[model samples]
Target: MLENWKDKYIVFFDGECGVCNFWVQWVLERDKNDRFMFASLQSDFGQKFLNERGLESKVFNTLYLWKPGQYYYTKSRAVLQIANVLGGVYRLSAVGKLLPAFLSDQVYDLVSRNRMKLANQKCFLPDLEQKKKFIEV
Candidate 1:
């Protein structure tokens, strides 16, 4: 099912992180164009991508957005790119680019460090349709 992902954006996140799961659900609800797909960093598919890129495979604190055959964005860059892809009102997030990436990423890291405290993990069961967006491979 993911073979044609060359044209789709794949989001690799921490499946066990409540904060990360919340954001994934947020994006899914607003994804009017169905341009995104997801995988947990603990999943084989997410680990393969990280290993291929020489990224930290044991840490699940970072988020990655990959556009196959193009490029992948991580941390704050991935967040902004995701917002941009959401389009319409979300395009306003482009303003974040005014700040240097290092500065933006610092904030991202800070949040990542405290993400677990931000929200408690809950049993979130996605509807059948939403389940289809996740790539177990």
Candidate 2:
């Protein structure tokens, strides 16, 4: 799906999950420069992206970041890379990179496993002013 993506970062997330959707909204709200494009794991574009990357479609356990021809990151690393792209205070999240990947991923796995339990089903509706930053594709 992303063979033609030339952007610095493409965020792949779980669209149906309230928590995931909320985070996407939060990122868009804070990202004043429109630095990311989103694709749900269930979307055709996302499926094609995973296929092209050789990742299993069934594993929606982590956010996926496709940074053009450079590299890809998952779980905690993905979140951190996204923060770095968003800049400002979000750049602080990059400190997570200091920890061991195994430990960082364990924390990410826990939050992902329990995100549904933490949030209600209502999806956040962004105001018109903030809606332009999000791409549902």
Candidate 3:
């Protein structure tokens, strides 16, 4: 299974969160190379991937990145890594990685915990072309 993802990066996120869904869409839109694939943490494939990585399955509140055979990253680290891959202005976000992990994660957690409330209940739907980029389970 890991070999199958050698050419792709996976982003596992909370499907029901308006903010998370929007971010996924935003990433897809800017991902001209189609280097990323997405899956909701609630999906069976997402759960299996987390379990295989020995990561807590309930940590879906923040973003997750699965870079095939490499180690997985979560929270702010995951977001920054994704941005770095996207290049350009997005790569600038990688500078935040210089901050202490605990402090950065605290901020990430705070925003994630409140994202749903802040974004309301808007459902994120990508366009037909973008839908092909999703690795739905």
Candidate 4:
């Protein structure tokens, strides 16, 4: 069922994290081009992706953006690509690319380490149309 989204960018995130959900909602709202889909890292499909890539399947701290049969991005790179794809004002996010990858990843790691405490978990109910953009719950 999930394979249908292979042509689009898939955003894999921690289902239990509120901050992650917030960002997912943010992207959903800004995704005027319908270029992205989403799945929780805890889902079977997400685990398959992680396991196939030799990544830590159980740990969902890192954000991932996958372009099937092409390449995938994690951490800061994923965030930037997502913004770039969303376009419009988000295109400004391209400036982040000017920074060294190591430096940007450090910021991503710091946020990841404290993400749980940064926001409280809540049920995010999207409208029917927005809901369709999610896969595997």
Question: Per-residue lDDT tens digits of candidate 3, residues 1-137?
Answer: 33344578899998888889888988998999878988888888888887886777886686898788788888988988999999988888877989988999999999998997887677777888777666665
List lDDT for all candidates, in order: 0.92, 0.79, 0.83, 0.91
Per-residue lDDT for 69-112 in model 4, tens only?
98999999999999999888888999999998899999999999
Residues 60-81, candidate 1, lDDT per residue (tens digit)?
9999999888789999999999
Residue pairs in collision within model 2: 1-48
Q: How good is model 2 by TM-score?
A: 0.85
> Which of candidates 2 and 3 reaches a greater lDDT?
3
Q: Of 1 and 4, which scores higher on lDDT? A: 1
TM-score: model 1 vs. ground truth? 0.96
TM values, all candidates: 0.96, 0.85, 0.90, 0.94
Candidate 2 lDDT by residue in tens digits, 14-133: 988898988888887777886776778888878888888889898686798876677888988888888999898889888889999899999999999999898787967777755543
lDDT of 2: 0.79
lDDT of 1 at 53: 90
Best-first order by lDDT: 1, 4, 3, 2
List the pairs of residues colliding in candidate 1.
none
Question: Model 2 shows how many backbone clashes?
Answer: 1
Candidate 4 or 3, higher lDDT: 4
